[model samples]
Target: MSERDAPDQGDAAGPPRQRPRSRAADWLRRRVGHRFPLVARLAWDDYRHEWLVSGFSVLALAAVLIPLLVLFGLKYGIITNLLDPLTENPRYREIAPITSGHYTPEWFASMSARSDVAFLVPRTRSLAASIKLLAPGSDVGRIIDVELIPSGDGDPALEAADDEDIGSPEGHGEVVLSASAAEKLGVGPGGRVEGVVTRTRQDRLETVRLPLAVAGVAPPTAFTRDGVFVSHDLLVAVEDFLDGRAVPELDWEGSAPRPADRAFAGFRMYARELGDVAGLRAELLRQNVDVRTSIADISLVQTLDRNLGIVYWIIAAISIVGYCMSFATSVWANVDRKRREFSVLRLTGFRTGDIVWFPILQAAFTALLAWLLAALVFFAVQGLLNALFAPTIGGGEPVARLRAWHLGAALLLTTAAAIAAALVGGRRVAQLEPSIGLRDN
Candidate 1:
């Protein structure tokens, strides 16, 4: 500035020339428009490029996860097997009175209305509860005395063992025989039998015969003794005839007429579920009603379940914390290494929020892949353990088992932990300044 040297008007008066804006920013604004999709794509590409690091992270995660899965599988399988027998069979749910007590109709009604009470029926004394039975038209004098118990709809003892169409004795003339009784009387379903009640009055034996049709045969496990399940009405009639009370229903002749209000000697009660059995028994005892149940066995199974669950969860918590810290440390180091790259993005108009998502997305991918690997390993080990223990375990039951919901819960927990770990690394990324990129360059 002679022009240049002499009072350069242009340099003195003109606005200072602006440094050219970074083309990367211009391209980002024009083509990408938003930072999130670009951030996500970059995160995925970087994760794929660093295959060795990602693979190691996944392996580490799986190492912890596989053991936890296997442990839970064993716990679940064992506990489930233990509980199944008690739950599936109704016999274990029975609540039998220790001694005969006078239970009124009002008491039975209240018990029947309870949510926990599955079935409740009145019972007579053992002496009057017995009846003589013989198959009609049998050439052999095969008459057997059987215990008569009252049954109606939803009678647990009357439930069929197989897919056969067996039902409870609903009518006075219909009766269900126990396996022993059926065998002894040579009577099956659709066969006719005569039930006789004999009473001695004034040195004379009086006999009353009631014809019965066999309805069904209960399973051997339901009742081991030779017993007959009849309607409550029929049982009451037998009791009445034996008490020297007239049973007009069966045309039985006696001295005294039956009373209008009736009370029972005892009852046959069953709980709706195994868990309810203890509560039902406790309530009865509180009311001065003594009863018996398989509470010791039930309590043992429940204790095992609780103890195993506690052990599993404790191990799981420790492993989860350890793995998460390890994962977070790895992610934080990766972020420190990529400070310049993140700074470049910031300088090119990317927001702190967008850049923070980079590590998080990578963590998610790592967690998902790790879960897949762990599941595969768990199933393999499960198969081997089950096969090895098959002969000893009995019933071809597996020693290890996992359900669909279990796998789903595991996946969710793993992902949540991974995201939590990535959040730590994200905090480090948020503190990065754009000038770091210029100094590095």
Candidate 2:
């Protein structure tokens, strides 16, 4: 047939040749049409008889890729999750170990100097340490709960709000007490808890009493129970008395960090903020004291992160190896079945490169399709697993969740590997010249 006489090919003058499509658009159309005729057309075309193998190749790839991607996604999610609860509420959850030589307000300020530390707390860990409440005997330990100051500036007491940091309290009219403290003091909303004060220059131990109105009573948190947390003024009173600025002053303190040889046991410290803990601890140890954390709490957190990491790696490794094996075998089998077709394309002037490119493209097409399907499958699997396993562990929502980024990354990497596999198999078929391949057909 004459070049201009073919159907879909018109004379240049006919409708001005339809404005001549841009080279890029024409090329794309031709490529798409050539690569994707119906299944029968692709199979019957001598040059494309092996193309069916690619459809199978993609399925194989997805079968391996999807599981691994989901696992890795879950792992990354979990590690980042560890900091969430603490970050959400910086005060109650985030606490620092006592790193200073003594549990004074100054040492508390120094240790909790970090911005991340929401609150610096000083409390006796155990309840039975000591109790000398004048006209009362409630043993106060570490203050557990911190709350919004009901009145005043809605800030912590001045002592709680640091100078630059606001870790000290806002000197308000009301005091917040623990429920246990209310029970121990034998006082209710308006009550009195008194303490002894001795003159710094005098001989006898003197006593002084302060009346504290319970602003509100809260349950015991990590800190105080049957314990009283009063206004910064009250904290000041205790501080001044202990510092010998009050009536009955215990003498002979070289410095604030000093402790009696038989000071009550159990480690504790507080800082103005969370960040300054390291510096405070180091200085205290420099002054000859050992710092220890609550070993149990630290151990629990570390264990969770480690185990999740290991589980992610193992699943990914198994999936990848299985995919490679399945894809390689499927492509090789297709190549053997179509030895005759490759022989004909060789005789028709298709170069070795063209022969190789065909299967490579086909494999890519299949991988793309399979990856999408696999992604959906992965999500389905995740849902199913959650429903099945969650019930055994008290039936709650999962801590970690998969995201689109994880699946997208998996798809790209899997497709690239599929292309590489296709190229390798295509190369072997391309080696057949017309003489060798034509002989078999």
Candidate 3:
């Protein structure tokens, strides 16, 4: 080929055509030319440039979150207060047999071995579980009959008693007195009392007086009426003596003591937690054992908690969906209006991935800022509500509250939702072509 004909190769393409750049590209180059990472700064600048729109988005999001926060705070506060007494105090977990039943040692062992059973002790019949107590140095005229409750290790009543470091009665000689019992005897902890047990055998009265030391005094919640918490052995001995069996332990005159496999009339039991009470009660009932418990009250509180939780979530779902849809639409429309600007960046060599981050960053910032605003507003409203309801809600408990975890969870959910909503606009940005800038201009 001739040299002139071969040289047409350079003229065929006519030196590379300069890529079209819009004013947005010139502005970006002037601001941050050849910067390693310009996506975040550009997004921020664009977000600031549209301050009015961004402000409205933030306020709209905050409006959605504030009411939800306040509603949830109220739910947590009111429900927690109602459930605290029943859950914290061990006394309310008590499960007592309605009528006497033959509960063997094996049965007691099985019941106590369960994970849900917090405490269990065998009890004697009502007739044999009474003791006439006389305070130390007092005459016989002051003797008062008090009900005896069998206690041992992990006794819920003793554990919940006001006295610290108080354990169950150690031996037959030691006993814990209920508030009424201690007051009636005019004694406190470390005091001594004379306990008298009587039996009518062979049409003759037999009386045995034993010295009892007071280990502690339980609060009124443990026992309302006059009662004494004694060792299981003492109650067994009293029952044996009343049954006319030889009481070698007490040295009371009677027949030979029965075998070691003797049955218990009933048992004192407690569940590990509020939820455990219902299942425990059901198990006992299935075994043909009738028992009394505060389950009705517990169930009422739990049901209220569950129902309120459902209602709260239902409302939250609706609000969250509405906010997300509205936010997505806003983000999408904003991207459509800024198509020419985004195309200018693309024409200037910014990749689709880089442009996609614009809306996402903006959305994340908006959500977080909204969350901050909502938190501030929620706390202010919480203080006002708490103060307004202080008189009705005793114990200085707040009427509206949110735990640390609750706020953290809310932040995570809202941030995630905002990002998801922005994805719609991000996809639109990704599809934009650099040629669109020229056509729009």
Candidate 4:
């Protein structure tokens, strides 16, 4: 035969001539020439056929993850409810002296001048803190505890209001009553009450009566106690009356009197913000003053939350390990059953890498479905728990909540774990040879 018409020796001895690839063909090849789509399709088909195994995998995942999510939600909700107010409210974050010390005017001036000090309210001696309250036009009254809080501008506790006719009374006789104290005294805003201040002399205890009026009633949600909130002036008046010092308003002049040094028991000092509280407390302690803040309680709560989180993670680790084992076992069994199919695919020009994707894809599907189911269960359980216990612990607020990032993280971890578990089956597929299919056939 002619060289052009006959089979060329070069072609016969070597490889056949290849066709030039188009851009579209090259793009397709780059995109999916590895047969990932086929592998995924086959994986899905296998999963459909093995419904029982797939269902069991999903259920196993849900069984482990749902409980952890639920516990985490509960812990988050309870801790938030307990700590939110202390962190959110500037008033509760105030640092106060645990023990009474003679904080002189100079000390007060120094503390008040600090950048960290947002507000400073002086505290009276604890022994003279309690007083009897006399209701208007009634001789019989209740002996109530009084908390001398700082009032006027820059007082973090009290909200400023404009005064008008029939509005809240202000100045010397004005005092705010806690809701519980008001309820007990059967009094409200613009009410009249008298505070009876008591004192102790060298050998005997003395009593001094001071008439006062309720200016406003604090809301029930306030982090205050069953007491009245009096200004610095009223507190000083009570202190002076107890010390046997008399004013012309009360019309009594006494010879017995305490030292003239104006010393406060302690001071309630608020930081500029929550983040500044720790540093302020430390500075106060450095100055040899005993300081107390609700930040300590918040720290304790955070420590508890971290401990609980560690426990939850430990439980989750065990569950994840169990899930991996179960998934790996199932995938191994499935690979064993599909060994011939894998070998056939290998004989048909499919690579080991392509075959490896099959089990991984199926595992991913299983994980996705499981996460969805677990999320549903978690929310349902959260709703039920909140409904049952919200009023008791949360003041009608939801006691369980899950953040969006939490769900995203869980899904990502679950998918990674499932893929890791499926690697065993992928390795098994990679080990098989094309001759296996020929031999089996």
**Separate clash counts for every candidate:** 3, 44, 1, 0
Per-residue alpha-carbon lDDT of model 1 for 1-441, expressed as tens digits? 233444411334344685465778667656755466568889999999999988999999999999999999999988888888887677899999989899988999999999999999999988999999999765555889999989988898777666565788866799999999888887788988999889987778999888899998988877899899999889888888888888787777887766756888899999998889999999999999999899898999999999999999999999999999999999999999999999999898678988999989999999999999999999999999989985588357887999999999999999999999999999999999998989987
In candidate 4, what are the lDDT values of residues 272-295, reduced to their tens digit?
A: 876678888888889888877877
- lDDT, residue 135, candidate 2: 28
The Cα local distance difference test for each model comes to: 0.88, 0.50, 0.88, 0.76
Scored by Cα lDDT, where does model 3 land?
0.88
Winning candidate number (TM-score): 1
Candidate 4 global TM-score: 0.56
- Please list the residue runs of candidate 2 whose C-alpha ends up more than 4 Å from where it truly belongs after superposition: 1-15, 18-55, 66-238, 246-289, 292-301, 304-308, 332-362, 399-401, 426-441
> All candidates' TM-scores?
0.84, 0.50, 0.81, 0.56
Candidate 3 lDDT at 338 equals 94
User: What is the full ranking by TM-score, best candidate first?
Assistant: 1, 3, 4, 2
Task: List where candidate 3 sits over 4 angstroms from the true fold.
Answer: 1-51, 137-141, 161-165, 202-204, 247-253, 340-355, 393-396, 433-441
Question: On lDDT, who's better, 1 or 2?
Answer: 1
Cα lDDT for residue 18, model 3? 58
lDDT tens readout by residue for model 3, 1-441:
444454522334334685577898767766766342378889889889989999999999999999999999999999988888887677679998999999998998899899999989899999988989989664433668899999988788876534476778977799999999888888889989989988899999988898999998886788889999999889899889889888787778788898989998998999999899999999999999999999999999999999999999999999999999999999999999999999999998788878999999999989989999999999999999999985687367887889999999999999999999999999999999999988986
Q: Looking at candidate 2, what is the lDDT of residue 65? A: 69
